[model samples]
Structure formats: structure tokens, C-alpha cells
Target: MDPTEVNVPDVKDMNIDNITQNTILINSQCESERVKYLFERLVTHLHDFARETRLSTQEWKAALDFLVTVGQISSDDRHEFILLSDILGLSLLVDAIDHPKPPSSTEGSVLGPFHSHKAEVVPSGSDISSDPKGRPCLVLCTIKDPSGAPIEGVKIDIWETDSSGHYDVQYAEHDRPDGRCVMTSDEEGRFWFNAIVPVSYPIPHDGPVGKLLKLLKRHPWRPAHMHFMFEKEGWDHLITALYIHPDPYLTSDAVFGVKDSLIESLGSVSAEQAKAYGVREGTALISRDFVLVSDDETQRLRDSNALAAMADLFPGKKIKLLDHLPVPDLD
Candidate 1:
């Protein structure tokens, strides 16, 4: 039986809206087992939700229009719709399911909309401060195995919102990479770069997504944080964020990227330590260490399976998922 036609009223004289009939028609076309099951569940839940809320015709139409615009605004470099998904918590839910990292490894967060291409590769001790406006800081980091032994020669790509809490992409012609750097760890798996402390900033609010946030009365701010992408041989790559100590939005990050283990105290340095690190007394230095897991054949197989399952659910063309998300390919 045609699923769409099945919903037609028994009497020939009965009348129903075209929209409702079209929804049923689309569901009928989704005959694959997975798609069929998903459609049935979604339709049931949506119907129940509308009944429970006594949804008005205007409210439903506005929601559909908003989604249509969201898709329309998404593109190769910009993903305003993904940001909308993030702020609405769907992104976090997907991350949680995909990356249940081992207890020893820190939890991950959203790869926000502003991550860009072509961070200039540089050596350790060179300043990560491509622009001089953020708070002056020296970040000292160590990459180690779970057993506390260093993993040699890991590449760390780091970026963060500037001192003013705005990324370079926020401004059209910043002419410099603010709070972003590409550095490699040494033979001992230790790396350090000079930069300024990052401030918490709001997500972009000048677009359709922003208008929706204002309509919903939600704040657009994310906590002050540093974004890190690390990779080394014989180990799984890491893409994670570190939250600033005492940032007001730490607990309520708009993207829900804050993880307890990822928080580090931006330590106050003594005069002597300041001199050694080339910073002034009373300057804040962020000292943190990351532990990456070594992957055996078993772990590699598990990761592959998880990636396959993710592709099945999200497909290649929908939501970008992990396909476009960069990871180091160590062959």
C-alpha cells in the first residue's frame, strides 16, 4: 500500500491539507529499512510533540522557514547551520556518541565555525601571536603517553579567540592570525609558544542564526578557551579545547565544549620563572599537559568501525560529520 495514500480519509469527500499529505508521501518513498524506521519514529514523535504543545499553525510554519534558511546559508567555508545545530545542542549529542574517549583522555568539544586553512608552520619558542593584541602569555605544553612517557615529535596546531574574544575570521581584514599558531613538539614531546591569554567571546550574532538566538532569548557567548589539534606516530590524533580558568562562561559554553579535565589553572609566575619564560612578573602562564593514547591494531579497527557507523547515520552530504574534520594521516 502507498504509505502516503494510506493516510487518506476513508470517505471520498474528506479533505486534508497538502502539506500533511506531502510529508506522508516522502515517508513512503523512504523504503530502506533504516530510513523507513527513522521516518516512522520521527513522525510519531513530531506528532506527539505538536499535540503536547498545542502547536499553532504560525509557529510550525516559522520553524520550517527557519530550517530552510539555515540550509540555504551553509556553504564550503561557512557553516552557519552547523553553528545553529551546535547552539541547539545537536552537535554536542553527536560528539558524545562518536567520541567516548577513554577515561585517561580528556573529553573533546565543538570545532567551531571559525577554524581556517593554512596556519603558517613554525618552530617551538617562536611566538604564536601573529597579532599582538591578545594578553601576553607563554603556553608550555607536554604531550605524553598514558604512562607519562613523552611521545616525540608531535605536531600541535593551536588557536584561540583573541584577548578581545574575537577570532581573526570575525574581522574581514585583521591582516594577521590572531591567537592561532602551528608548532611542533621536540624530541622529548615538549612544546611551548608565546601568546596572550584568550578571552571568552560570543559566537557570531549578525546572521540569521543570531536573529534566532535573540528570538529565543539565549546568550551567544562561549567561554575563553584554546583550541588544540595534536598528532604523533603510533597514536590516535587529538582535537580538543582547553577552557580558561575562571572564565564566566566556562560552565555555560554556548557550544558545550567544556570538559572538567580540560580546565587548567593559568598559573601566576614568580619573577625568576617569568625571566626564564621571557614574561614579566605577575604575568599569567598557562601550563598544561596532554596525554594521547597509543593505538594498537585492535584500537585502529574499532576506530574504523565507528567511522563507518557515523558515515551511515549522517551520510556524506549531510552535516559534514567527520569527513571534513581534519585528522593527521600518519602512514
Candidate 2:
């Protein structure tokens, strides 16, 4: 495309009254209709916000500088931008819009920035953590379709924090996997594992997003939960977490990722029961059955009048689920 052939309005003598229109006019040359529409709307909203707030030039510069700092602090293992989005509830909102599920299906939640591709596959009933760090827990889960039929061979990735409310990756000298593992469901669609009772923890609060939270007088605590990502051929991938019932932060999750349907109680396990589950005595138990929607069904729901009305901005372009992490070799 020749630069001289590009159609755009002249930028001379631009003022607040015409700046937004000129910006949209120039952006109209975008080749992709979806991108063009998105940016046009984005510009309009941004300009309207500035005008309505009477934003000063100094405040705008400060906001840009804050974003720059966010980028500067991000790394391969740490995603500050994702934290920013999570703190602002944008991540959960986007997830809700993209993944509309049937009432029977498990609800999706925000995938925090700490998921690692380094989790190793372990056999069912094996302990995810090498050494016990908190009250032992036996997690028994079943994967089933919406119709209640067992779905076998669903890959499940699980992770959680230790008693002190810290993940292995949060350690400065983090070098080995702990409190996380991957496994597959059995013929009965059942998978059981030994884990710690997850505790309520603070999201990483030493960054710019934390500063923003402070400015808003919001706490940075999340409810106790265990992360799970399930994947199976022909099924819509599900990224969700099970919240511990009676958690103080259940109604005030920092990331707004909790759903009433996803909450489960931790019950006391007797010595015989713990032995039966292949865990030590005094261990607690949490049992849950997850219902997955098939890919075809998910697409149909996305196109339905209910969901389409809320997320029809990108017609014909389905929102892709997060890519599945590589299946680790079974130990």
C-alpha cells in the first residue's frame, strides 16, 4: 500500500473538538473490520472519559508512566499486565463474555498469573507436594458431561498455595515444582489426589496494580481455592477453581473469580476413610463433580440469542480457549 494513496484527514490545527474525529478517521484505514471497529470504539470511549473527567495533561502523563512501569516489571514467569486486568475485573468479565455455559456446567474463573508449564504428571492418589506443609487433604473429583455420563481421559492440571499462602513459584529461589501436578481421569471419570488445604492468600501486591488497589482502598486477598484446568478432545476446555466454603474472602475475592456453584465444603475424614483414600489420618476431604460442555454445544450457546446479544461484536470469530499445556510424562 502506497503511503500517498492512503486516505486520511489533514491533521493541521487540531483541537479537542475535532481530535477524536480525526483519530478515528485515520484509524478507519485498518484492513481488518474487527480491529477497526474495536479501536474506533476504544478511541471514542477514551476521549469521552478524558473530556468528561476534564483530565489534565499531567494526569495523562502519569497514567502512561504507570503503564510503562507495569511493562518494565513483567517477565516470562510474572505477568504484571494480567495482574492489572485481574485487579480491575476485566479478566473475569472477558471470560464470562467468551465462555457462556449451561446452568449445569461448571463456571469458569480467572486463571491467575501463576500457572506454570513445568508441572509434572503424577498418578492418581499420589501426593502433589513432596513434603506436607499444611492440613492434609484428599481431593476426589469426577469429570462428566452435561448429561451425567462419565468422560474419561480428561487431562487435569491442578495447583494451589501452601498453608502460608504462597505458591512454589513465589519463592525467590524457586527451582522445583511443589503444590502442583497434572493427571488424567480414570475409566470412571474419577481422579483423586493428596494435597494441602489451600489457604486464603494475597495476590502479588508489590507492583503497580497493587498501588492502584491501594488507591481504590481495596484489599488484595483471594479466597482459599484450588486451580484446575481440564482439557479433552471434542470438549470445550475449562479453566476453573474450587473455592473453599466458609472462607472469609469468598464474597470479596480480589479477582472476582468466585461463583456460588464452585464452592465446596471441606469435610473431616476419619482414619478409615483417609486410609481408604490413601492419605494419612486427620486429612480432610473435598469431593466435586465437574460437568463439561462439548465444543459443539458451547458454540451453539455462543450463537444463541442470550449470549450473542452480549458478545456479538466479533461475529463468526469464536473465542479460542487458552492453549493446553504440554502433557508431561507420567511418573
Candidate 3:
């Protein structure tokens, strides 16, 4: 049966109850009850959304072309589609809907395009600072309970851009290391780092996503932030990004990563504390703690990690590991 020829209810004549009744009727016959129910709900909502937005023919065609470009540019080595979704704020919305963490816990943000699996894991107090010429930063981090008591033995995987606001992936040939650190907290639940202060930077604007953003009159920049993933044996593994409170794009990040709870002031560290952390004078530091809820679904959390790891595992069949190796900065 042709859907266009069917006597579907018109937008002007539709009400919530009528839509609900139609949805129930649509679910009455199907090979899979689950799929029938799901599609019924989805169709009604999608129809209502299109009607409410008054979707235009030109706008819809543009949207389809944008998505086609996204798929066209994607490969095993690159996921421009995910990057497109991220810049459009769709990725964050999906993450929010799928994983509703505790209100007091750290909020999840966009898992940016450059997340690599090859980061070297370091222990507490180990310096993973990549470039020495960049502005010095001492990150004093803690993991604790809601009452503020330190929660020892928590592991934190971290990464950020350099003073120039470029990630390692951007300078594929330059070989400079932008701050990428993986460390665990000590017995006192404290982990301090000596790193170059990260700078705000634009998202990759040379790609299709950038062109789309230009068409929409949106910038291709994200606010200054440090990515952090916290994990513990019995606690929920939290993946989040912390934004510098004073970042200019706090209200207008191109990637829409900014969240009110994730913003924290990068305070001035006293000379004594700086010296204790081996940070020289005049260097700035940011201090913040993450709180994680206990993880009851261990298998599900492990499965998610396994999936991410597998997705990024192998390069093309014709390419060798060394062939895809990033150039190291010999200078």
C-alpha cells in the first residue's frame, strides 16, 4: 500500500489523543511486537516534529545532503559522520538521553574526534606534559564522595590541547605532543599534574562539517577544556570534559560541550603549594574533584569500553602499524 495514497490524518486535524489512537492501531499487526510498538511511537513523534517545525523542502534537502556527505567521508580510519553529529549537538543529546547520570555527578560531554587508544598510562604524580615551551599548568585533581571525603584508588584518563590549541592529530607531520595523560589517584585520592595550559581552539574546519557550519553561520570553535574519564572497581565509569570557567565560548561553544555543572574556576595556587607540586613560580593551576556514582551494571560498562576499543583497534588491511604511525617530535 502506498503511504501517500493512504488516508493519513492531516496535521491540522490531529490531536494528541488522535495520534495516540493512530499509534495504537498501527501497533496492532506486526511480525515483531517490539518493533511494531517502537515504530508506532517513532512515526507519531516524527510526524508531529515535522509539523511543529514546519520543515521546508529546501531545508530538508540540505539536511539530507549534509548527512550524505558525512557518510561519504567516513572510513575505518576516520569518522567524519560522528564529528558532524558532534558539531551539530546531536551526539550530546543522544548521550544525555541514553545515560542519565546522577545530578551531582560529573556530566558527560562530546567525546571529540581525536580520542586515541594508544595513550601511555602513567601513575600518580607522573608528568605527562608534552610540550615544554607552552604555558605551564599544574592540575590538582581529587575524587571524592558527595560529602567531600577523598575516594582513593580512582583512575583518571586525561587529554587536552597545547598552548597553540592544536591536538596531535592536527599536526600529523609536526610531531608535537599535545597533553595526553592517563593517571590514577594516590591513597589520598589526589592526583596532580604539571602540564602546559590548554588553549581554546577551533574544531577541524577544513572538512565537510566546517562547510556546513559556514552555511549555518556558526563558528567552528570549542571552549578551552580538559577531557577526563574516571573509573573505579565498583563505581560508575564517568566520561566527561571540564571547561575553563572564563572561556569566552562558555555560552557558545561550537561543539556545544559547555555545561553549567562542568565549569570550574581555575584558581591561583599559592607559591608554597606550587612549589610542593614542583610547579615553578608564575605558573597557573586548576583544581577540581570528580564524583562518580557506584556502578551496579558492571558487564554493561565493560562492554561499552570493549566496543570502543574494538572500533579503534585495527587500521586498513593493506596498511601496517608503522605505516600509520604518527611522526615523533625529534626536536
Candidate 4:
């Protein structure tokens, strides 16, 4: 029973097309089981999509070209590929699946296309805004554990758009770092910095992603928000955002990063009035606290899953499952 020629369609270079989809999924045998499974599933879905869409060779070539352009524009300071994933909602989906929010931990959001390790480390309440055109804003934050205890010495990296809704990366000659800073928490896990209140800005549409959005009739505006990357040894790194409440795009963030829990309120204050708080009188004030989970706490939560932990809710009493009943006739 020779199977290669029996069931296989007889044609020149027949395996090239794989139109039958019976081709054995070929992958490296060295890959782990999970990796192999993921690769095979991805291939299956992609091949199926091509077949179902009856994708023409021209369309496939166009997609390849589009990707090439995206790569051409991406560099050390820019990430056009990440921008593509963001607008397509894949970034948010990946984050949600990878970091499912446990208990009181802060929710994660997209890191966006513009983040740089070049941010300068500064003291608490230092003015990070080199763009004098930007409106002054005082941001105060505290990091604490789920048990309401302070987590000292956590490093907080803050970055946001200029008052004009433009990041430092957008400007080619802005050699000086503005609108970004790295600060550490005090003994009380408190840290603050002075900057501009971020404005809702459009994701750069000058590249292939912009063309895609134009063809799809979609907007690329991210709501007003700030980015915070909280990191410390032995603790889960927090990549999250604080979205300014009442932003017009809150309900429809282009990257799908908005969450109700992340919404923060802003207060307008005078520089003289802010003098009491030790800042140079920032125009807007934002005070919020972030909760981080320790590695041990995360492990404990994992060992005692949600359902297991709920056992205490009904001490020794078994909960009954309700029966499913068929729909009654309206007669």
C-alpha cells in the first residue's frame, strides 16, 4: 500500500500548492511540544484562511510588500511593526492572555510604538518637560502591595506625549529627552514628577499602517494617557497606563488599551498653589496608587486557584447547580 502516489494528486510540482491541505505539517523536531503545537496550529489557520479567501498571488505579494515597508521604517527609536499590531488589536490581545490580572494587581496595557531606555534618571518632583511649550502637570504616584503595605525602591519610568500630542521620537532633531523620566519610590513607596498633561494624539499615519487605516476607514487616535513602566528585582514588571478620564476616545481607544480601573482624574492648580506641595506650581495634578503582586503572592494565588479559594465562602456547604430548563411556549 504505497501511499505517496496513491492518494496524492498527480501533477507537476503538486506539493508546492498543497491545495489538498493533506501535506504533513513539517517542523523542527527539536522544538518543544508546546512550540510545535503552536506552530502547527498557526500554519493550519493561515493556510485555511488563504484557501477560504481564495487569495490571489497578487494580493499575497502586496501584503509582503506592505510588511517590507513597515520594516524599512522601523528602527532603534521607532517600532512601526508594533504600531501595526497595536492598531490591529493583536498587542492588547497578547497582553491580556499573557498577563491575566490576578486579584489587586494593576491591569496592563499596550506599550505603544514609542518607548526608550534612554530616559534620564531624575529625582522625585524634577521637571522632566524640556518642552517649555507644554502645559505644566504634577503627577504623584505610590506603589503598594495588595495588603496595603508600601513597596519601597521601585523604579518608575514615565513617558507621555508633549502638550501638542507628539512624543519625543516624532521629532527628528529633539536630541534632548523630554516628556520622559525615570524616578524611584521613596521609603513610603511614593514618587512624583512634573510634566505636561498628555493630549489625545493620532498614531503616526505616515507609514504603511496609515495607508492600511485609510483603506479600512479607521482612525488612529489614542486617548490622552500616560505610560508607566514599574520595575524592581524579584517583582513582576508592570507595564501599564493611566488614562485621563473624560477623554473623547476613552470608549474607543485605537489600540484597545483603555480600562475603567485605569481611568484617573486630573485637577487644575496654580503654580503658586502647588508651591505648598513642593512642585513649581504645575498646572494639573494627578494622584493615583498602583498595586504590585510579589512573586510569592503570585505563586500562592496560582496554587490556590480562584475556585479553590472560594471554598471558604461556603464553609463545608455544597452549592447546587441550577438545572437548565427548555424555553416555554408563548401561546
Candidate 5:
């Protein structure tokens, strides 16, 4: 259905009994048909929510004030609104809806607010971890096609908190060499690095999100995991995490970002095994491979990634026909 067709709903004569008609009237002002449809649907649901809860004027004002504080606290280092969305699991839900992958292809996960364009690039096999705040760990990753063919020259960006559960950005110095670095796959599609094993950490508190959690009596912890982003031409820019299985929070991630297929085993290496890995005893090891879809099937995905990479700033960027897909009817 074309939401912007001639049948746009008008609510100029609407009364309290016909408040939903106001939403269709709001949709009439949107130039893009997809935007019109989305605004109409969102306004429809929002109006329903207000009616169902019988929300009062005071409650609405309080909600708006809370959101204003969230925006006031947001800055380059911290995004309180994203944190609010994470605590509500909306971030993961949006990711799943926007990027569905084949079983053979790497699954997507939350691209947590920590992604920085200033990631340090390190040579292959270099230690991104500055010191042993936690136990030593070796990470070995491989990138390949669904058919197990190696994909060389693929850029792999990685970052994680140290065992102390503190990201480099949390410190006073702007340039800390903690558990984070960027690397690339070689001819064999392999990229290996040394880092400290991460521990589960609470998402940042001291904001309105934390206040909401207090009101809801919810814990604010995420599972131990290393963030990975794989990008290359003709492939979907895969944003995912290699979650360390057995983490206590695996089943109860505060953000609901865990996927069963993304869970992988991590084990401690002995002296003999550690020697081959070029690490001493008591080093944890990670071994996993990611599969990418063939180029021919990724046109829509490529456009999506390009739009995202540019922050959707392309000139006259309208919703592509590919994006006008029918909303999945969960009912």
C-alpha cells in the first residue's frame, strides 16, 4: 500500500474519540512514502499506547523531561540515548530486523557505542593488550566464504575491555594501549592477535538509564565478549561478537545481544600448546572462522552498509525500493 497515495487520512475534524486519525494526518506531511508509512505506523502505536495506559499530561511531561536529561548528558565519549536503547534491547531488535543473514553467513550483533574511527592498526600477531591486568589470551580468527574459500585482504577491526572490564576510552589519557587494535586477514584469511581475556562488566551507569534500571530492579551487566567488525568490497560489513561461552551473563545479557551460533569455546593453553601459539602457559585461546555470503546475493546488503557507513548522508537519500519490503507480520 502506498501510504502517500491520494487516500491520506485527514484529522482536522478529529475529536478525542478519533485521535488515531491525527496520526494519518501527520503522515500526510512526509514527502517520502516509506517515511510516511513509518511515521503513520509509529504514531498509530504511540497513540494506542497512550490510550491503553490512559497516560496523563503530567506523566507525558515527566517523560519528556527525562529524555531531555538523557540528551544533555550525551557527548562524543558517551551516548546516553544509545545506552538507554541498549538497556531496553531495542538496539538488538533493530539490528536483527535490518540485517538478517543466512545460517552459513556470520550473524550480526550489537555494534555497541564503543566503535571509534581512531582504532590503532597493528601488524599481524602483535599484542594489542598493553599489560597483564588479566590473564593472557591469544585470539586467532579466519575469514572465509560460505564454501570455505579464504578471503584475503579483509580488514578486521577489533576491541575489547581488559580483564578489569575497562575500555581504553574510560581512562583520563585519550591514547591508552589496552585491549584493542585493528588487523587484516593475510593470504590464508587468518588474522591473529594477543590480548587479555575480558570479564563481564556493567554498562555505564551514572545516567538516566541507570535510574530506569533502578526503577525496574534490573542488573546492568553484559557477557564477556570481544567485538569484531569484518569489512570488504562485495561483502556485507559484518558486525558481530565472539562471545566467550560459560560467561555467567551469557543467558542474561543486559542488552539481549547474544546469538546461539555466536557462542564459541575458549580454553586455557598449557606450556606445550602455548609454545606453538607463541605464548607462555596459562594463556586462553580462541579459534573461530566467519563465513560470508557470495557477492551476487549481497546487492541489497551492500547498499544498506554504504548508507550506514556514510551515516545516511548521501544526497537526496530516499528509501530505496529494496527497503520498502513489507513489514514482517509477526502475528
Candidate 6:
């Protein structure tokens, strides 16, 4: 482990032309091959971007400053980096890459910065809404495997914004949890709960990511949707949301998290039917069946060249994995 015995090439007098090569050479000495491969491409792309754009020193400094601010403002309750990733569509891309599912299975979406782990576990047909202004809605969901068999004992976490388009956490007082809860699927794979009909809302737009969005001339609104996270021992953990159809921002969600299959319409419920679901009259109903992929099936698909399978999921798009770059000859 002597420093003199280290095999990294000399990086002295690095200029624009040789700086990337020398950096990659140093990174190649990493003990982990995966880390080495990742940094090599990362360094190559980062340097290429600087060179291609002729990025000025001031611009580089500003970018670093922006990242610093993003970190400084993030806390236990808020995640600015995830917001940045979502805004840049990286979150959706990563989800698509790692959680590839069959056509029949539900697709994944962004787990936004507002997710709270402190949600209370509630029984079926319980109302999670705390805001009186929000319209009452009954969400009747069924969980099943890809083969259409009911999967019991699935832990499902659900959350959404109230009628005013703001989560409970977004409020200044934010003392108690509302509009979010955790429930277990019954033996029939059914779990119904009373919640407010979610309305379209803008993401937290008072931070650096919001500034970037403004700079890019983009709106910060997301479509009306309810978030759902499903977990079971044998099934793949699913993170998805059901978007309300005819939403203004459905086609142009700021986070690019919407998929055609996830769009659903709210059904009208009769007074008796609403009462049966434990909600008041004129309550809207969202009845949807979620199909989860098993871990074995997910692994099989992942091992069978997920990049190739992604083509079917994302039609009319070319997906490419980064090819390993040849190490530079420093000799």
C-alpha cells in the first residue's frame, strides 16, 4: 500500500486536451471495476460537454454554486436533489431502466419529494382526508399478481394533495399527517379508503430547481394524481400513481412521470353505493386493479436484456447503453 508503488499515471501540467484522459487514468486505479467504468464515462461526458459548449469559467462556477445551494436547502423533510432529478426527467429515466415490467403490469413513476414515512397505518374504508374543503372520494383498489391472482397482505402507502392542491406537509403548521395513510390489502387483494379527490398542483417551486424551471420557460404544474406504493415479500416493490383523466397538465407533467396506462377516470357513485364504501353521497370513485410483478419475473426480465425490452415499453425512442471507452495510453 505504499504511495510510491501506486500505478496511477502522472497528471502534471494537465490542459484541456489531456485533462480528461489523465482524470480517467487516475480513476482506472479504483478497486471496483464498476466504479471505474462509471467514472470513466462520466469524466468523458462531463469534459466533452464543457468543450462542446465552450463553457466559461463563470458558468462552471455558477453551476457548482447552484448545486451547493440545492444541498444546503435540502433537509429531512425536503429533497431538493430529487426535485432537480425529477425536473430533468432523470428520475423517470432511472425508474424505467431499473424497474422494467411487462405490458400488463403497472408502470412506475416518480416518488416525489413530498413522500412522508410517518404516515399512520389505517384500516380499510377509513377517511384520510383532513381538509373539509376537499371533495370526498372513495378509492377502491385491488392488488394482484401478473397472472391475475389476488395477493393478500400487501402493504400499500397512499398519499395525495387535498382539493386546494397542497399536501399536508406543505402547510406551514404541518402538525399532523393528513391526505396520506398506509393500509393492508385484504384477502381478496382489495383495499378501499376514503380520500379527497386529488387536484392538479404545482410542485414546490420556491427553490433552486424552481428557478431552473423558470429559466427553461416551463410550467411547474403536475397533473391531478394519487400516489401509491405497494410492498410484499415476494413481489417487486411498486411505486406508481394514478393520474386523473382530462387533467390540464396530464400531457405535460413537469416531472414527465405520466404514462398512458396510468391515466384513469373518476366514476360517479350513488348515495347508497357511497355509503357502502363509507363515504357520503355524490362521492367520486376510483376503482383500479394493480398488477404487481414478482421478484423472480422482474429478475428474469432484467437478466434477459432490459435495455432491449425497454424498446417495447417506450415506442419510437432509441435507447443506448454507454459503451466502454478505451483507456487512454499515457505512455
Q: What residue pairs are clashing in model 4? A: 271-281
The TM-score measured for candidate 2 stands at 0.89
Candidate 4 Cα misplacement greater than 4 A, ranges: 1-24, 269-273, 280-282, 296-331
lDDT of 1 by residue, 1-331 (tens): 7766765333333233343344545575554544554565577668768868888999999989988887787664468988998888888777665555676765667778777665778888777765566667778889887788888888788887767777776766666665677887877888888878888888888777889889889889988888898876777667788888898898888778888888887887789878887778887788888888765632654466556765675465232223423222223
Pairs in clash, predicted candidate 6: none
All candidates' lDDT scores?
0.73, 0.86, 0.72, 0.79, 0.79, 0.87
Ranking by TM-score: 6, 2, 5, 4, 1, 3
lDDT of 5 at 187: 95
- Cα lDDT tens digits, model 5, 29-91, are 767665666777787888888889999999999999999999998877678898899888899
lDDT of 3 by residue, 12-123 (tens): 4656547666665645456554455457667877767767888888978987887888788665435787788888789898676445565566778887787655567777
Ordered list by lDDT, greatest first: 6, 2, 4, 5, 1, 3
lDDT of 2 at 139: 90
Residues 1-331, candidate 4: write the lDDT tens digits: 8766454434345453673344323452424544544565567778878878988999999999999999999988889999999989999987765455686899889999888988999999798887788777888789999888999999998999998888887899988788898999999999988788778999999899999999989888889999999899877777899999879999888889999999988986666657756655546888789998876665444444433533555455442211211111123
Candidate 4: worst-modelled 10 consecutive residues by lDDT: 321-330
Task: Report the C-alpha lDDT of model 6 over 28-94, residue by residue, as the tens digit.
Answer: 8897655676798899999999999999999999999999999998887789999999999999997
Model 5, TM vs. native: 0.83
lDDT of 2: 0.86
lDDT of model 6 at position 157:
93
lDDT of 2 by residue, 164-203 (tens): 9988888889898899999999998999898888899999
Better TM-score candidate (3, 6): 6
- Per-prediction TM-score: 0.73, 0.89, 0.70, 0.82, 0.83, 0.90
